[model samples]
Target: MRRAAYWLFPLIAAAVAIFIVIFMIQINPSAPHMNDGTDGEESDTSPQITEQSGSWLDRFSISEEKGYFYPVNEVSLKLTDGGTATVAAHYRLTVPLKSSYELFCVKEELKKSELPYFMRKEGETMTLFVDSNDQNRLVSLVTKLKTYQIKATVSPYTEEK
Candidate 1:
């Protein structure tokens, strides 16, 4: 009985080990081929991720831009309040934007707020144009933009003839 007990335990263990090995092999059939006839060197199966110091948008694309004043898009002044006043500024991204969805979301919010602003994508930057005779309205709009982590300064407001 003792002999049978010892043999049974080892046999169960061996069976379990064999089952685990077989399961692992079935799950991952591709084994690292080392010194195969095709090549005498081992293949690299590790993942490679190259990272650079810039905005996540830069990860989608790269530019030789040094400062924050890179023109992202083109802007045209359109006033909902029937004013020709346009505020042009080099709107810089203060935070790492998650995605272009953030821009769309902000645009939707601005539309709901009835603020006269238009954003157009030129290359990588986005252009923001605000048309309001009352500078206070523009200031309030800019202040509201801060909630979405958007920061911009007053630049030369030009009118295209």
Candidate 2:
């Protein structure tokens, strides 16, 4: 009787431990529920990417406004040949200096160019907008800007259809 009682005590403790483990697993919030159509099952509504889809972009839907804008550093001659019409690539160049002296230098350089540009000062940063369609002008602007140690980034601006 003593031997049986000793073994029984350990057996009961083991059973309780196993029960606790099972209960914890069942109550875990992070577990992904399966789609078995049962009370605890989760619906398989999450988006899945398949091999047939070229990229994540194919699976996702993008609005008209989000698709076209690309920043340009240097002028590129590439045109949107097929899907949509693109007017120009926008560029952003930041001069490290915020002083009016530096700003004046930049303004003078831009004034020397024949290309049409829209300039605005926001705080210490200067924003220059140029038409993307004119590849020659872009090339010239990029070349000239580079001489002044000003690097520009080309962003795409798409025309709405």
Candidate 3:
């Protein structure tokens, strides 16, 4: 009986370890090509621009005197408090054309109590405010954006007469 108990203890421990490993793998399934041809070195893929740095809307023809020629779709803005706002319409930015060159866009979402901000269901044009220096806000927003599985695109805009 003593020898049987000794073997049983090791067997139980091994089983527990295997179970834990399996559970971890299940929780975070490895990507298809995570380890197919890598030797602990980074891949040779080109760097991607995940987010635009400067005032993107201002650069385009979306300024106050000039309205946007193209429409934005499938874009969602996430707030600091985990609240999300859907892009409704594009508006003009009141800032100077050369001063930061900011543009505004209307967004529709439930009123958030944290910011005391409300979006109009009709004729609602809200200013999209973003701080170029706020790295923390940018990181937080980028993390939340991963759930949408979207890639940023830079579309060429033509000046309207």
Candidate 4:
């Protein structure tokens, strides 16, 4: 009985989580397959691309007020072609692992800050993906994780002599 309890608890928790997700999805306004201009608004902004359009760059409409607002630490792109509209939002984050840091601590810290994050494997120390759109939140997360001498850097720039 003791051995069975170890597996049973996790299964129950997973089931509850799944149900909650389903419930949230049902109430969500922008759930999948519901954004086909069914809300009585014209779909002018969500125009389609055609072969006659020539270059894709010409179709891009970007402005300061109604500019394409992309989420930080996230990638979301909306593309239209002919009679179909596609929305793709994907998450990709990586933080270099310079020193030893416990996975549990990182997780707890993210949770405390109310950020969405997922860890693939503890063995993969160099990759930590935290889902967030707010720039300040992302900055705060980096600051909180600075328990040691960890610095985010890009490729070294070469200067002309």
Candidate 5:
């Protein structure tokens, strides 16, 4: 009986350990493979995104322009008093923009507010055309620009046809 008792415990433990290993392998079975003369990747995910410096709209047009303005989208300016105005296109103003760097600083605001005007550079002066007949929109845009220290002008613009 003493001999049986001494061997029984170790025998039971060994059996349990063997069963545990077998169960584990059965649950998560794996197949071993030798290097199959091909790239190990079975599938690939989509590519990563890239960080661009300037607006993508600048690349849309192909022209030999020294002072190329960004994409000029035809926008119908919405009046602040719940109306639409068609007179925005006739007006233009020259912004006191020092460099392209200044426009870059206000880029976020332009995108956030969805200002519907394009700026063109001529000589040493950068021009900003207010796209809306609503004076409030113009004032709001200039105020936001001032917040960014860009100091964009809200001066009146007239286009002589």
Candidate 6:
């Protein structure tokens, strides 16, 4: 009985360790298929905008006079080849009065451009900057126009300078 118990103890511990390892693998299988493969697909990727099918816009009061900021708004990208892509708007703001704001908007058009000073695009993301001068320009420009709509698209990439 003593010898039997001694062997059973190690067997129980080994079984428990095996069970834990199996449970962990079952819970989180580290398989490559789990990834969406965006890294490889990004080279040929184009901008796409999600279609607004159910009219959720009606629920929210989307107005330029409301002095609201629409963060990460979706804008449809119109490609030169007569195709459309759905891209998220990094930031959209309608300034009713002069105000300081910090936001991000994704601009697909800027990505297609070669201008290094204004915009930068990498992979499937883009980043844009609205400095103090840009904010002032926005305030001045919107004041003159009775109604204005400003949509900014930004990339989510760090410039490699």
Task: Estimate every model's Cα lDDT from 0 to 1.
Answer: 0.59, 0.59, 0.40, 0.57, 0.62, 0.42
Ranking by lDDT: 5, 2, 1, 4, 6, 3
Write the candidate numbers in order of decreasing TM-score.
Answer: 5, 1, 2, 4, 6, 3
Clashes of 6: 21
**RMSD (CA, Å), each prediction:** 17.9, 15.5, 22.6, 18.9, 19.1, 19.5
Q: Which candidate leads in lDDT?
A: 5
Q: Put down candidate 3 lDDT per residue, 37-127, tens digits, no spaces.
A: 3787766554353225345555453333343245666657655766675543322211111111211211111121121222222244333
The sequence of per-residue lDDT tens digits that candidate 5 reaches over residues 1-161 is 99999999999999999999999999986754433335766533322321253343443432214333556677476448766755553333235667777777666666786766677778878765555555666778778777767665555556559
Q: Model 2 over residues 1-161: C-alpha lDDT tens digits? A: 99999899999999999999999988975634433456877655544534354453443433223344334466556656688785455543333444566556566776786545566777857666655455555666667767767666554555569
In candidate 2, position 109 carries an lDDT of 70
Error of 4 at 119 (Å): 1.8
Q: TM-score, each model?
A: 0.34, 0.32, 0.23, 0.32, 0.37, 0.24
Off by over 4 Å in 3: 32-161
Give the per-residue lDDT of model 4 (tens digit) for 108-154. 77679877765455664555676544555666666766774444322
Task: Indicate whether candidate 1 or candidate 5 has the larger lDDT.
Answer: 5
Candidate 4 to truth, TM:
0.32
* lDDT of residue 88 for candidate 3: 39
Alpha-carbon runs more than 4 Å astray in model 6: 31-161
- Please tell me which model should have the higher lDDT, number 4 or number 5: 5
lDDT of 2 at 69: 34
Pairs with steric clashes in candidate 4: none
How many backbone collisions does model 4 have? 0
